[model samples]
Target: MVSERAAQVLVASNRGPVTYAFREDGTLDARRGGGGLVSGLSAIGTDADALWVCAALGDGDREAVRRGVAEPGVRMLDIDATVHADAYNGIANSVLWFVHHMLYQTPLEPVFDAQFRRQWDAYRTYNRAFADALAAESAPGAVVMIQDYHLALAPGMLRELRPDLRIGHFSHTPWAPPEYFRMLPDDVAEELVRGMLGADRLGFLTWRWASAFMQCAGNVAEDGRIVSSAPDDPRPRIRHSPTGESAFRTTLVGVHGLGAEAGFLRRRSHELDVEERMVALRDQVGGEGDRKTIVRVDRTELSKNIVRGLLAFRTLLDERPEWRERVVHVAFAYPSRQDLPVYRDYTAEVARLSEEINAQYGTPGWTPVVLHVKDDFARSLAAYRIADVALVNPIRDGMNLVAKEIPVVSDAGCALVLSREAGAYEELGDEAIVVNPYDVTGTAAALHQALTMPDGERAERTKRLAAAATALPPQQWFLEQLHALEALGEGGEEADDLGRT
Candidate 1:
């Protein structure tokens, strides 16, 4: 066995900054990941002694791990495929995702039985693997930052192994409110909260989500193992151990609403690929810009409420016949989590509804709706550039980046019809025409309002929306969290990043 090097800073997540693809031959094709995390980590500089720990997600990843694929500062654990499925699809996506997003039917679902218990055990084992890897790789007094629900339990597990390290956990989804959170088995709920409270600090995309987490952390059903400060407190803590033997652990909490990288987005939106796709999209919507375009880009996730969005577009045509061929709806419903039955059905339903609208409203010279199932970044950018009105109505979301991205990339100003429940609403609600996600009639009316707004007003609103949306760029958002976490150890003000916005 080869020895490993210790790192002063580490990041753990379900997926890493790179992925491997198995080739027809025996070789593996490695691809680097791009996004906020990649950009943020790069900002810390190469000499920071940073490392990323993630699980092998597929056969290709497993093969690369087996061969000890040497990509600097990354360690991929080749966990069992069965365990990965149970932890990822069964619990993380199925249970935690449903709870956080409030997607359960409630009448016929969420029956945690013997099989669920088995899966829960697998989830623990999966988390233990990550915790062990992190413990082995971390230096004394190091900082370990964990990401998302997939590894919720790892923080507590790692704390037990390395009590001296400073740990932080960031949740990328809206935390379920206390009432809905109690739907979980009592012990399981307590375990999850206790696990996360092990972190020195916790971060959320919005204050609403962070508040929900603090409520659950305080109210976990147990023998008062976890108790938080007053609800009015800006930053709260979870207290553990009543007796002073092991002392108490207080977890500092803060919100860091992730924002778009304005510079990269503006540059990339004008790339050759995006330019070509924009031309293609313009021709499809209507040659020579004769028609208005209502644009929506999202994954086929149930929480996105894509079906209701399509229904509202249909309602718009039915209510106002004059706009039939005068406008087009461009929808890009990208496939997500296709292995799950619910996601597959949702994707099919989106397709079916798009077809229904086209058949009902389309004419020889015009197509009312142009639906694309596959995901292409350039195409999404192209759609963003050409949007006259961007409809973003999700049932509940962490922060719908699409809502922010459109304003930043629109060549001609785009009016936003946003959902009140989205995390982004907290930031952009003033400039957006906000509506209830479930109110199709209200949404149709709002769409008409957006479509009819004076060009000058729309252009002005887009500027304000874009400005507010990019207030904290990705690098700043990330560094804020790191600074707040680091501040905790320096005997300085905690959560210094909070309220700076």
Candidate 2:
């Protein structure tokens, strides 16, 4: 049933654990990638017998592929440039991402026609490249874990290639409900669900998303109907056709809320670089005296709701005159996906809003908003440390780790004002001042509440939030999924047993 020579585990995702950059001297510089997935894999330790397969995203990566360069435990696949662009920028980001996040205007957009079909074909080819690479690298009975919406089709594609391998697919984004998911063409919706059903175990960030997935599958599956034997049970079993034959021998669906590495954050928050930046930030926010600092650190992505966050801050100033000179909003709006026109426009809007607020309520001693548009991790950690309140209001997110990270690293307890729509709300809602992402006035009220929160109450809530955020660290998170996949290879009952953990 097993081969000693085969790799014990394989991780597949759009981006790898490490990325290569070309230096002026034409030499490759390897830098570790950043994300929850990378952090989880790193927690598994270098001793684990695992291979990570990822696509070459840039020219440096393509050149590295040409040179046949390999990282310690990584395999890079060089797909055609045009196909990769269409699949990633066109279909994945522009189409699928918009659909899942429910970000479309509905009436004017999502016009899927001949061009969409071409991009969809390229998307298929892109997934095929990854499936072929994973199939080639995997050993007999190896457990393969595919990550995120980018590779939604890989599980089914890989299953067709290697039935012996135990496959699991984890969705890092929130799954759209059946009604919204039906926006896809009939055939495309069915194919997407069937692709994911190829996995032995399907994992999501929350049970809500898992239920949504089951609903979508039920609506799309012509021959299959999903039935929950127990109403209260979070897990749903799908039974296909009149024969009652289950597809893929029972796909175990589960919820694993990804969290930040508290141990790492605790240690890194006090480093010299972070300390230096923290001092500068304190001086910037509290120029003359101690003023309350409301900090928001996010990429300038549309879903992050950065412009609305700025608007809420403006509303706070207009409604509550006392906070005009006593509070400062330090917004670190880092640039992300600059090549995309929509992202560029969003970034410009954030800048415009921040300037409008500052121009409207400017004093020599206090500026309403201090915005930074660059990538600086140390600076972000610095902001986290000095933050009196951390604002995280994504419209729809898988799990906003920043919501968890701020509470863990804040020097003085920070009040968290989180969006109800964020996936993090499932875990941190009890302690956070939750606001509707679309309500600017409500969010402004929330900000005022957070800023005026009592010190003792804030400290107590921070402790509880930190405990819940890091309950299952990255190491345990990855291992739990691995263990579930391994158990599936053993038997259905064994997988269910592991799932209970």
Candidate 3:
């Protein structure tokens, strides 16, 4: 029923498509994982001549790897626990994530000492494990698609091992500007850029991030200038030499704004469980009277700007006392990366702030702030259905799918209060209430406007916003990249001739 292809597609990332959990009886249960990357892969189907290589994160995963019981289309690599921790918790999450999100405290934080160097070594070793596994499993002339900041160096490592393979790297996080990126150790910063340059195609979620990457490359490249096609080109081929001794390669860079699966969301939102949750949420927000709901669903990640969102809600109550009990802020702040102490502290701060807001503005019959910190997809969908105003004010984000998703699932047309810093702004800015993420007063005013928007106006904007958000569905987003890579391989000069002599 399927045609055979010589070149297979290999996907490398920190986490794979499915995760395994072992029961007490020594039986393992495999569950489909969550994330934009996994969602995109599902678009390609299971029989696309594709193999996924990823790290085993938990004991269950490690045990599964030990038993050679990987999923149908996935391969899990179990590295030493210590090495994985240092590489993941240390370099990737602690260092790179902070840099890209611009979350470091600067003078008080990020002291890269001798211990950091050791962790950097572990990071390299961790990437090498992925490179080794991908190299071993890939078919001849396979197209390898690597994901995110966790495996930055793997592309170069894999290229060195197998020059014939076609490589593409996609960044799911914001690319730090040249100034902030230069904060890394000189050699390390250059290595990161050079490592990614090994890929034949590099994709970013937005043109702003793509420009930031090109600026960083220009700063680190040998000649201090990367040649490009045109200023308005969507996908441009740029040439850069990693070092004076290295030959220049023409690496193509493009923007692919990942979108939500509208069909999936529409179907899932109507499930019985979701409807039950919707009723519960309506009771929580509406109490005895029908109060407008300002909803935000986010993980307790620092860059999410949850604290500021709550503060703005407080500001709204202070500045506009007439709207006190008429509106409720329903926040679903889910737990994420709790293993990191910084994340734990941020989550605690979020709780404290939410409690403070509730204490400040509480009536006998209505609560101003209703906060939930657990992960519940159904509850989120329920909130989406009842929300009058959706607040997605991330300080910085790759795509912030929540901004796009809320409009798709809303019942009676929701108004979006979006952040200019979010990648979604590039597409949905014209329809949503755009706010500067740092300005509490501006966000408060924007929230007030969103709440008071005329029903007809809100409905029209929601229609346009939903259309823009789903312009490139996850399936189409992924297949477009694959097709672009395939075309590059077919039309370009030999891979060997492009990079080195």
Candidates 1 and 2, the one with greater TM-score: 1
- lDDT per residue for candidate 3 within 110-225, as digits (tens), equals 89899999999999999999888877877776778999999999988988787777889999999999899999988899889888887888999998999888878777655654
Please name the candidate that would achieve the greatest TM-score relative to the true structure.
1
Instruction: Give each model's whole-structure lDDT.
Output: 0.89, 0.85, 0.87
Model 1: lDDT to the true structure: 0.89
Candidate whose lDDT is highest: 1
lDDT by residue for model 2 (299-346), tens: 887789998899999999999999988999999999987889999999
lDDT of 1 by residue, 40-124 (tens): 8887898889999999998889989889885999999998899999999999999999999999999999999998999999999
Candidate 3, overall lDDT?
A: 0.87
Error of 2 at 481 (Å): 0.2
Model 3, C-alpha of 31: deviation from truth (Å): 1.3
User: Under the 3 Å rule for N, CA and C atoms, how many clashes does model 3 have?
Assistant: 0
Give the runs in model 2 whose Cα sits over 4 Å from its true position.
1-6, 225-231, 240-248, 490-501
TM-score per candidate: 0.96, 0.94, 0.95
Clashing pairs in 1: none
**Model 1 residue 109 distance off true place after TM-score fit, in angstroms:** 0.6
